[model samples]
Target: MLLALIEDSLEREGWKGVSPMEILEILEREATLRRRGSITPNDVRSVFREVKKARETPVLETLRKNLTFALPKLPVSRHKVKMEEFIAASKNMKLYSDQEKSREIMDAVYLIRPKETRQQIGGLHEIKDRILNQISLAFNPRMAELGYDSNCRFLLLGPPGTGKTLLALVAAAENNVAFIKVRGGELMSGASYHGEPERRIKELFGLARQRSPCILFLDEADAIFWGGDATSNKLLAQIKSELSELTSKDRIVVIATSNKEELIDRATRDRFEPHVYTVPPPQDDDEWNEVVEIHLQKIKPYLAPDVEGRKITRMFRRERILSPRGVAETITEAHRLWASEIAAANEVRAATDQEKRTVALARFRADLERIEHMLPAIK
Candidate 1:
């Protein structure tokens, strides 16, 4: 069990493999093991030598010979020395450090690619500028020298599907920092079931610190921080305290989003009020068009060859406002339609530009109409 836990910790620490020495160090540092007894690195080396010796013992060789007759078969290492080499190579791998931990967090988070940077997002110009400025100040070396370690926290307030999450992603990408996303709803639900709200808070911030200079985005911020009375309120207050402590850690920038700013608890709002930015739905047709155009360009490569952008944009904007997510969905549906046409034709040749446009436009129009009616409030 100890060995399994050590391996698990090593894996979590971004060590795909380990040397005998590393294994020993990991075991010694393991919380599970440290609580029970003292285990030193030197002791680990001694154990490694013992295990190597035991594997090569004459008694083990004799037992191996008898085991063949005692059972159907037994799987055993043919070269015990190979284990030593494997362990040595692992020790040569990158040491576990903040950089390695950051890489692991980057892999786990939903990385916002370069194309999805602030440039791709339409409107929200004020919010975008504010975020970029904060990022600039945070990245500046002078911040540390001046001891101006203010929490670079921002709260995005808006209605659902108003691009709050997208803004967070774009900010992370533009700043060239690791992105760490968490849903407040999930944390709150888990806490309710297990009654470990404080621990959950610690874990979230701990990960952000491990991957310092990263953007920690908490979506649905209101869900976990608001809407609780007496009993649940105490838990909410405790969670808030945990967050309050993290405010001093300038390396981790927290961007939290909520559908309704009012729904956020008064205490929570006051805590993060100075940096809150309201993200409203697209205010006009021009903004909406830009959102559609952004998504259309992304799906264009898969679209019928040489389809005119104007026609596609017109069809998507027949008569409605679409959130960034809605636009993405619409384009995705159109791609499916184009793919289906190709599948049904079973032709060796690709469809002509006109054919692709016609088929895709028709499919997109249908899907858009259905989706608009079904989820009108989302946009």
Candidate 2:
């Protein structure tokens, strides 16, 4: 149990940066709370080694399968635990079980406690404000007393990598609610038996309601909601029925994203009508500069003094890196290149900060040029 707990903690996004002692402390605390007995420093060290070995060995497949099989059987005084408590514990440990039959209804959905607030998202000021308002209206307890509608739904329309998904995450983060993400493809693919797809959809909504004051984000919504076949129609109907059951008092907000809005039928689009927001690429110089700065801030220390935010923004425009995701990828690749060069140089002799910065700027420009050639020409 301690090994699994430690492994789960290490798998989480920012937890890899934590020190071994800190991880041990956390494991000790969790174990003590669960009355599973105290975890010693040596125990944590051994488990860490095992975890590393498990990752490197081919037996990782068997280990994962065993973990999945054992998760539902987690002893609770020899009695079955409530689903809500089970899921809450899973979330606390960041254990996303996509294999358990008992949890198959929620297998396609994952819960996220988003670290990105509205302030963290760059550009789309108007859209951000509107989303924030909608979240406030849906989550604020006082709004219901004042006769304001709390049933908020949003359909974020945008080109690929234009921050549509990021906006949904920010909405949940800003409201301090559970972010339940469902990829339409995964949701649809999970249904094997007849009527299973419709049943999964209904149960998904039920799970959302149970975890209320949450954001039910359906990413790439057209993948499942696009009506064509009999199964697709049934799944769509189930979603619509579940959506209708949501009243103003329910703090659950449904946010869907689609790059190709035309693929979704008019009836489905009408459900999110008047609440649809288009997330376009950064339109103005200020927006572009802000985006560049936001993405480049991580590597700012290695950037040359002359590598201004506007200069990066201009490079992005020149390279036709229109999406925020494109800009981020370019910056990340450049930084990786710069760091590798610096590391290689350090083996020979320690380099000055000025040398590092100069190398970083050079790599950034080189990457931008390479990306320019790679991107398809705009019609």
Candidate 3:
């Protein structure tokens, strides 16, 4: 709590230096005013020293830590030549006047590697196989020459948090193709003021065409295609028409997601033909266990080292609440409680590993009760 407060204060003041003693006095005064237990001046000094040391680290080092891959082991000359060749190739591609717009659009989407293969994706194995095979067939020129449709356009209908978005990233990673993602609302918002939306949509598709053998994922697709009286909204009609045209392009696989499949217009629905897969939430005990295990693994690194996944899985199985999102939220809430416990003990900066594990487990058990209360009623 003190470190966070100090960090916030530093940011607010534009990082102009503040004396450790001055901060200690201010915190002591605040503690008195709030009738909370006071922190020792020694602890305050320790936190201030650590924060200062942290600030001395270079920003580039922090960024390097978050990178997925290390720098290539190529000679500088060869690397420079490769970069220049890539730049030249990009320039030679005649796509649009403002190609950066499409680049910006692609930048916002997350590029996931194929760590979670089709088998690792809990349930929906058959649907996963269908998607994987479709992508393979569509990308094969021989299949097209043999009179196949070769259009890999698909509509993934599912409830929220059923991994529709994850599947798109998985597909892109599986095929080693570039994944270009855009939300339906972004298109709608762009279409609102001027005719720019339609032009932008067309340009985006053109960019996708330039980068063929890529997946173009439209998230929350129903937002653009859903609603009463499409003729009443010119923006909606225009955007939908643009999407309809864009999906027909070959080698440009389009995957769209919708929570409410019924709301999508028949015309738009027709475009994503013959492969509309429904991804429902985990239902039975086995599926729920898988969901629990998947999320527990995701959050395991953030929690105490000694905290076992099996224990958490057993507890989750014992509970009545079992949404994939709900499990994640519950675990997150437990971590928050653990942080609070550390803060209460006044050893947030110097907490021992054993202390952290004990507090975290206690908090996890407590939060499960809170989560049970928060769970939605079974319909």
Candidate 4:
């Protein structure tokens, strides 16, 4: 009740116009008239401080908005300001010390509100369903009522460019939650001072908890958990503690991706057991066709009309462009080559649609040949 009153006053008069003493006096008067328990100035001030922090802390504000979406019953007011806007405001407010820490945390962690859905992911239908189901259970309020385990930890094992990152983004987006991505190497590198890495791990998990119904993606997990040194062991211990601390009520799902699975320790790997999934490159013609078509559609506007997508897909397959990333890069490089030619031609005369289409097809074939020798053949 006191918190509501403080919030109301702050909303009406702004934080500058409100005073803790005034709130204390109001509480004291109510207590005296009602013959209730005595109210102390310290009590009123403490509540006031909490309200002040909620309003000032940018991360809290971000989490509040996320909570408002996840749990409508919560009485958190919506803020028009974004996370970056709040950080900018904090700079002028001379809250540099706190803001600096927040900025560093943000720098190490990449926050993404993903718009990609499972449908956007070409193949991996079984993997997609499994991930979505796990995240759905984690976010479902009914699961908590039924005493179901809602917290999940996933370790995505895959080679480079196998779309592990995309899977994580899609899971968050499908669940209508925030995605916080942290590279293992980057997180460790930021820990220049003694115990800084452990501190960062705590902050990262703390932030994830605050932003419940979120996906905390740790990319390149090998880099952080691979080392056998004292620092690596300490960092690993801290991460284990954080993961173990997650309860069913916390809607945070941790997804760690690693290309070098051998580097991860046994204990660290066990933390994500029963949920570990290996994401492989496109294995069949249908998957390749779909993935190739998806990438082609993205660059369709720039391609020549006569450039056949089917031919391109076959070419990708023949050249062993197995991974989705490899296919996308091949397409992108081909487009870049064609675009450059068009730009150069514009200097003399604007190229016709026919001319552009011919050049685009040629470039696509040329890039395929170039990368055929460059790309390592899948063993």
Q: Report the number of the highest-TM-score candidate.
A: 4
Candidate 3 residue 1 Cα shift, in angstroms, is: 51
lDDT of each: 0.59, 0.68, 0.58, 0.69
Checking candidate 1 for backbone clashes, the offending pairs are 19-87
In candidate 4, which residue ranges exceed 4 Å CA deviation? 1-104, 190-192, 350-379
- The predictions' CA RMSDs to the true structure, in order, are 12.6, 14.0, 19.2, 14.6
lDDT of 2 by residue, 1-379 (tens): 2333455545542234345334544544454344332233344444444444433355555567677554232121222222233223322442122222235555576665687966657798767787778767877878888987765778889899988988888878777776788888888785778899888787677667655667899999998778888887887888777777776677788999999988986677778767888899887999988888998898888998888999889988998998999999999998987676555443323335666656644545544344444332310
Q: Total clashing residue pairs per candidate?
A: 1, 0, 0, 0
Candidate 4 structure quality by residue, lDDT tens digits, 90-134: 222321223324445666776656888776677775577887788
Candidate 4 Cα lDDT to native: 0.69
User: What is the C-alpha lDDT profile of model 3 across 155-262, one tens digit per residue?
Assistant: 999788777877777777776665677787665553444555556566566556644557878888887666475432554566566556643235678888998888
What TM-score number comes out for model 4? 0.67
How high is the lDDT of residue 290 in model 1?
A: 74
Report the Cα lDDT for residue 5, model 4: 48
Where in model 3 is the C-alpha error above 4 Å? Answer: 1-116, 193-196, 227-249, 299-322, 339-379
Which numbered prediction scores highest in lDDT against the true structure?
4
Residue 338 accuracy (lDDT) in model 2: 67
Alpha-carbon shift of residue 12 in model 3 (angstroms): 55
Q: What's the CA error at residue 139 for candidate 3, in Å?
A: 2.6
